[model samples]
Target: MTRTTTVRIAMNGVTGRMGYRQHLLRSILALRDQGGLDLGDGTVLWPEPVLLGRREHALREIAERHGLEHVSTDLDAVLADPDVDIYFDAQVTAAREEAVRKAIAAGKHVYTEKPTATGLDGALALARLAREKGVRHGVVQDKLFLPGLLKLKRLIDGGFFGRILSVRGEFGYWVFEGDWQQAQRPSWNYRAEDGGGIVVDMFPHWEYVLHELFGRVTSVQALTATHVPRRWDEHGKPYTATADDAAYGIFELDGGAVAQINSSWAVRVHRDELVEFQVDGTQGSAVAGLRECRVQHRSATPKPVWNPDLPATERFRDQWQRVPDNGEFDNGFKAQWELFLRHVYAGAPYRWDLLAGARGVQLAELGLKSAAEGRRLAVPEIAL
Candidate 1:
């Protein structure tokens, strides 16, 4: 018979879309349904979640919907429980730091959504506190686990991209303005005071993706814009959108390869996916999105004549070959949760810790500062 280790997790922010769908339903509940996580030594690690939220009704509804046994409106009471081993936070950026601080003080292992705090200093402080308290700490860096990126990583590891030259990424789709149609995103995402902006929101994701796949970002030059200045809220009331809806950035990597990315909530997508990245190298080039990747080798490169007087004859997009998904890919969020759970239970090495999260926050801080100063800025390394 397998020994069972029950790990109680206190989850905050289950009312939000990301928190509800990804963290709660897709990850924790999915693990529970699968009869706990296999710990490789015949010990099954089961997660018992206690949902924590500000809205009692919403929390109760979610708990009852899922057949969960526990729900709490008071974070302090949950944290005070000696049985709770981990505190998972998926709250908005503005409220994250305080809750995480309390969790750390309570000696709970902490895992949180990115931009761990609204600013670099707060994020770094969290890292320091977590370290001082001798607790396992992590922040979600889920993009690295995506199927498309996994294929890209496989290609790079196989020497498909010999001496990689550069990477270009496009991420975004038009978020409906609330006046004519309800906005897909929350109103707080357009309010700077509420810790919302494309730069702060996305640069952290870019930072880790680039750092892990290409190289560490040495510097950044960025321009931001508030393309939709007025938007209605969930209540359908008009309010000024002070935050930037778009950001165009050029990041210089440590290996001399430059990465240019355009992030926008206002732009319409004309590509295969909502987000896509094209990597160019000496031997070959590849384009990858959330679930697929296509590659073109130097030997198969197309040559087209420039003729202003005639219609284009070349079918450029058809030339690249699709990279096959060689293995089953699990949901990115659930995969990360499983890894983090193993790390918490069996002391497995988890690299995407709070310090890595702080690096992401550092990039966002510099990106925004670069936009405001109208100049390129250096990305200094952070240490705790």
Candidate 2:
């Protein structure tokens, strides 16, 4: 009989939104509820997570709510616990580096949300540290796990598209205008010092998706804007918006595939999740959204010439077909958490590593530089 390895994880920042979703509710409680899960290969075991945080009251509340008895405000205490085999960081971006360093020092495997650090250099340093410590490390590239994106990946891997051409990503949602006692959605997401901003927050997701679907980016040109300057906080206090609300960028991939990404918090979107990516290739085309995948291919019957003035008709509208769901739908974040646990426990190959995360920061940095300089910037070669 194969021995089951029980991995105990220390979940830092269990109080935050992503933290709660990825670590607590999904990673910890879900496993407990499911009586443990099996990775596809049947070799790895599920994980048990111990929630750690900075606020005792909040930590206790979370623990009580989840029926988790293991909760603490002292990170050092968690690290010192020999039973904690993996250190997961879901803290705010500014505090991530320090937390990760401590976790590495504690001889624990590490996983964290994207933009692993504030900038490229910090990300690289952490990557180096993980290697030096000889510990496994990973980052949340949840977008790659999205059903829509995964379908896209399958098509790409299967060569459904003859030769890749270009990709376009649209991501946004109209954030509430903070006024008249309206609570601010998330304060940390709007402050530069706190690692707020659509570019830094969302680009890491896109970078991995694009790289996985197409290839690594060779260069980028971008423009950014802060559309809303101020907003009301949860306590009815006003705070100045210090981060970019919108970012538009064009990326050149290693194989010459071009990608365009747009991220915004100011636009109202009709789509449920306000996220979609379209890929056009030599022999086929596909568009994917939160819960939908539409495809058009050369094998399909050909139609008359496309007319500019034509209304919605069979030639255009019928060209696309929606792909059906294969199983129950779960949040992409949750799916990634489950996968990460399986990887750490079972020796499953983790696709999203620190190098992938660093490339994300590299893209964002280049985008910022390009936007500031009013010119395109070639992405520097990263040592993988």
Top lDDT prediction, candidate number: 1
- Where model 1 places Cα greater than 4 Å from the true spot, the runs are none
Q: Which candidate should be chosen as best, given TM-score against the real structure? A: 1
Please provide the root mean square deviation of candidate 1 (C-alpha atoms, Å): 0.8
Clashes of 1: 0
Off by over 4 Å in 2: 1-5, 39-46, 180-184, 299-318, 326-331
Q: Which pairs of residues collide in candidate 2?
A: none
Q: How high a TM-score does candidate 1 get?
A: 0.99
Q: How well does model 1 score by local distance difference test?
A: 0.95
User: Candidate 1 at residue 201, lDDT?
Assistant: 91
Q: Residue-wise lDDT of candidate 2 within 25-78, one digit each (tens)?
A: 865677667766666565446466787887889988887876666877888988
TM-scores, each model vs. reference: 0.99, 0.91
